[model samples]
Target: MRAFAAAAIGLTAAVALVLTVTAIGPPQDGTSPEPLLTTVPGPKK
Candidate 1:
């Protein structure tokens, strides 16, 4: 019974987490940024 209760609690927490993540709406700014790292140096090895 104890194990069952623990499993139930864990499952509930996981479901809640998934719901919270998905419920978070998109960014309001509507402006997507570009990558910060464009090029890499230090070669010829």
Candidate 2:
């Protein structure tokens, strides 16, 4: 019973770590604070 509980806890922690890492995603090719929002601004209509 203790082993089962430990396995469950380890699995949960592993899944959470994977999700957190993926959620943050890879770093962009820039040094900006917010890379996605730091692209060249588009021309106004």
- Which one wins on TM-score? 2
| lDDT, model 1, position 16 | 97
Candidate 1 segments whose C-alpha is farther than 4 A from its true place: 26-43
Candidate 2: residue 38 lDDT (0-100): 66
Tell me how candidate 1 scores on lDDT.
0.87
What tens digits encode model 2's per-residue C-alpha lDDT throughout 6-31?
A: 99999999999999999998877756
Tens-digit per-residue lDDT, 1-45, candidate 1: 999999999999999999998899667787657756667866788
How many residue pairs collide in each prediction?
0, 0
List lDDT for all candidates, in order.
0.87, 0.90
| Deviation in Å, model 2, residue 2 alpha carbon | 0.2
By lDDT, the best candidate is 2
TM-score of each: 0.57, 0.60
* Model 1 per-residue lDDT at 26: 68
Q: What TM-score would you give candidate 1 relative to the actual structure?
A: 0.57
